[model samples]
Target: MSSLRETVPWQEEPDDGTDGPVVPSRDGAAEDIRLFDGAMDPAREEGLLAGLELLGADAARGAQLDFELLRGWQQHVLHTPQPSAFRNLPAFAKKGRERYGIAPDTRARLDACLAESSTAGGRSLPLAARAARACLDVCFFHPFEDGNARSAFLTLLFVLAREGVALNDVGLLRRITFQATDPQDALILARYFDAHLAETRRGAACPGS
Candidate 1:
């Protein structure tokens, strides 16, 4: 089976010259917590909140992305006393429209891709692109045994928060279903990030309604 990770158009997404606001005024992740809570069972809601708390702390400390870091969060996302482990077999998604094939080096590849989410060494990917790619990476990599969608969402949030950016709203981001093989999906995700970032900046400039 063809891997979704191999087809993502990471290099094709354009960087709009700016990376939105350097600081965000509101907690968009908190908003997501509420939104997720309304849609999920109580245990899942608690897990989401706990995962978000871990994301906030990791972002504050400038922690880089990695399997270990993700596992730390996935424990909360899965509502498990222990961190979730990487999947030992292939994973399917989109009602079987996509298949993420497994390999001996799959976890290593995932780790390498996660590391790219960092802006270190003067990496030029815009904040929006980095976050979008990180989300896609998690979605397609299908790293954990369960809760990969929630994990992807948290990864995106961490990418933005690490750089002092957060959205006041993320409905466009969280509600969409992206295809791994479509290059347009990658660009569209980046555009969504751009939209949210712009709106967050505007809200920050205004302070109060």
Candidate 2:
């Protein structure tokens, strides 16, 4: 089978034009949901919460996307002393059905793709598309040895947070696995982001009703 890292439909994903140029919305929806997630799994959610905190801090300072930045988040995610480093050898997922082979320049390629996650790279793509793409990047890249799913989730949240778009409900995102090679999956994820954005905006409009 071909490497998922290469087969993933990263470039073909389209932006959901429903919401244009997102403005900052300081809704602590992520925190609330993460708290709920914590109740189910403390150790796992603690790292998620920690990573979220780091994401907020990094967003506040207008930090750029880089491997080290991800490592910082991954360190907390896996409860490791140092930042988690990129895997040097091939990685597999989906019970050995999907393989992510590493090449000599794989790290560099991953870095370049991540850099596009920044707001400056794809100006035309709306917040949802960019955020979804970044999430998928982590998924397909399989950067770390473990906890890549969590890392991908955090990346999605960070992208939305930086753009001031936090979802009131991430139920659609949770427990849903995406395919790397399917363009439809990309569109579906972007639509999920749109749905959450719509709900969050509606809630903001009527806070106590």
What TM-score would each prediction reach against the true structure?
0.91, 0.85
Give residue 95's error in model 1 in angstroms. 1.6
lDDT of 1: 0.82
Q: How far is candidate 2 from the true structure (C-alpha RMSD, Å)?
A: 3.2
Candidate 2 regions exceeding 4 Å error are 1-36
Instruction: Score each candidate by Cα lDDT.
Output: 0.82, 0.74
> For candidate 2, lDDT tens digit of each residue in 52-87?
889889977878776778889999988999888889
Cα deviation at 123, candidate 1, in Å, is 3.2
- What lDDT tens digits, residue by residue, belong to model 1 across residues 1-209? 12545566667767766664456576777777776764777778788888888998999998979888999999998878888888999999878888888898889989888888887879658777788888888988899878998999999988887877778888888889988778678779988888887877788788885
Candidate 2, residue 149: Cα displacement in angstroms equals 0.7
Candidate with top TM-score is: 1
